[model samples]
Target: MFTGLSAFPLIPTDENGIDEQAFVGLVARLAAAGVASIGALGSTGGYAYLSREQRALTAREAVAAAGTTPVIVGIGALRTRQVLDHAADAHEAGAAAVLLAPMSYQPLTDDEVFGLYRTVTAETTIPLVVYDNPGTTHVTFSDELHGRIAALPNIGSIKIPGVAAAAAPARIAALRAVIPAHVTIGVSGDWLAAGGLLGGADAWYSVLGGLFPEAALAITRATQASDSTAAREASNRLEPLWALFQRYGSLRVMSAAAETLGLVHSPNLPLPLLGLDPAGRSELEATLLRLGLGA
Candidate 1:
């Protein structure tokens, strides 16, 4: 059901807990920029670092701030039961959908992954989007696995990581051909969005879209209209940002951009995940300026 760009804004926070005011403003900004949906607790939102109460509170506050914008809450956990509980909490918080990733401390088998989704789908009535992000989950969904999960009742969509250069369009086509008619295939990784959108991805579950929705949405609208020239032009404007993503990390770059824009304060990300390097700050600032987003 996610047809175009969906924004995954950072859950702004400091050392103490969620910064409700900053978080609300971030979500409101994305909504105002006209993103298709607001995804709370996504990669940028630091779902793993938060406690149960914090996650629930963030989802609740996000929904309230989003106004009429649809909210998709992330509920990925190592344990299936924990995910179910989070999904229920998201549902109660008035979320429009829930996103699930196969995050594990212990290495997981295909069967374990399958069972996790099966159990979550059985217990949760809210629509679930399978997030096939091997970068974070350390578990990749095989072609067969993608089809199986998509067919499950209420499995509304799958957000796939963008593939290699040559594989995008064909891979998207293959995934679409196999997944149930009701299941949408979304693409993540901002750099891969151009090829994925041109290739027929149903949605762009985007990090950049959260920071600058109008720019990202311009690409979405252009791609949807099959205006390859415009799409490439918009995407070209992001070359510096994409390079930062490749060199530093999406979280680091996004946090830096958000802070530079005065959209939110530099968030206190979870342990082990550090802030954007001071060494790279000037470079990022230059990129931001070139993109016409004043630093």
Candidate 2:
């Protein structure tokens, strides 16, 4: 469940709320593409914006649509109680695993973050993925903190943020030395996925994979086959898309891409968030066409 490409699809929505049909189509598309897992309600899925009921619905639909593919649902919330509730909901939905990011309005301390994991893991039977995305959650995890949280039962995987290509090997090695051997290390940051995989990370918790699994899987398979050159080449081929993600943030870029592909209606993001502007959309369309990703 923790290895290979875990595609995190966007939970398409509009003023009427979650577009269940589009969301299910995204999940089914990923399942058919043979991604290692379908990561619904992750950062890409806009889990933080949805109500508990909405999130639970998304989880149930993702698992159902994914069929044989493993489904990892994000269960992050501001409060531990809410997180526990979300975890229970995910378990009830028959999710293969749950991903948790330490989300907070007030900055959290290392101990506070550790306590969050300890409480959830102690109460839930489902496996947890520690999402270390400082970019979004604003909670950073030191190697020491990661080791402590990973020591808790049900700590299945750690989804680490991107490291530079030069540092990936040492970073992964350092992480491996501290955590239990059973606990896998998955890499986020789509641009750095190939480097992370080649550097010995166990999985790619990918944004691009959610929309375009075939492109992401090419890199994953090349890495699995010990073809480092192929993996790097595959990643490099998507550099233009990666550049767009870096410029506009993945959520917005992916929303625009989904709309362009007609997978979902325009203005798919949640309230207070808007899709790309005209110029950005034009650029994205050109890039997509150049990459042979046009609808």
Candidate 3:
């Protein structure tokens, strides 16, 4: 489907803050690069740092820039009401779907998590997608939960980060066994594109797609088309590029890579997260050069 070749975390950042114009350019670039969908205000987009208005504005900008492509707004928040509110805003702002995580207040009971998705699905007309990123949320929704949620008419997909890259294939296979055909399984790990495709993921969401949409899309399409050799070569070519961010962390180093490639003006990060250091910057640039990504 068109959804398989999209970029998440098409974030807006500059030396100052969210760069509206730059973000518009980013959307256009992703569309031209052949991305069929895009997501904003996701974890990597620093959604927590944006004010409510900024969040809505970002959604609007993304939708406006995306043209005919689908834009999914990240509606995840620490509160249920907030997620519902964001879902409303995103829907009004032209989002085709909303991606949300379970509330972060406490370790949720299975019933509570199930109820949460039920409530969200009930409250929104737009399609809702479950986000499963155990590294950040420390919660892994069971396949049982996915089965239940995926059965909901409004639930469209599950975004699962392949953080445990090695074990991802098994987990993905298990997830695929339960989820419905229309309810997609989205992988969110930078290095697990081919593996995820082979394991039955319908689509992928990761910063790897943001920095290298052309290459990531190529790899995903190849794998989906059963071209194992081409997919392997594509992944191999992107290994050093992924390593550049893997070595220093995706969020921080990706901003630097964006700046180095002239994709964005500066690596402006949120509070408590410092921008790249000189040595780190030098190393990232060198790695990007080696990957032939530093424009």
Q: Which has the greatest TM-score?
A: 2
List of clashing residue pairs for candidate 1 = none
lDDT: which candidate is best?
2
Q: Please give the lDDT score for candidate 2.
A: 0.94
lDDT of 1 by residue, 1-295 (tens): 4779999998766677777888899999988888889999999898988988999999999999999999999999988889988998999999999999999999998889999999999988889999999988899889888888888888988999976536888898888878888898889989989878888888999998888888899999999999988998899888888899989988888888888888776655655677887879889998889889774
Residue 74, candidate 3: C-alpha displacement in angstroms: 0.3
- Scored by lDDT, model 1 comes in at 0.87
lDDT by residue (tens digit), candidate 3, 1-295? 2258658654755436787887788777777787768877787787877777889999998889888888888888777788788888999999998888875768888787788788889989988778888877777788898898888778888888763545667887788789887788888767766777766677877677766788788888887798878887888787766676667778888778777878677656766777688999998888778777776
Candidate 1, position 126, lDDT: 84
**Poorly placed runs, candidate 2 (over 4 Å):** none
**lDDT (CA) for every model shown?**
0.87, 0.94, 0.78
Cα deviation at 295, candidate 3, in Å, is 1.5
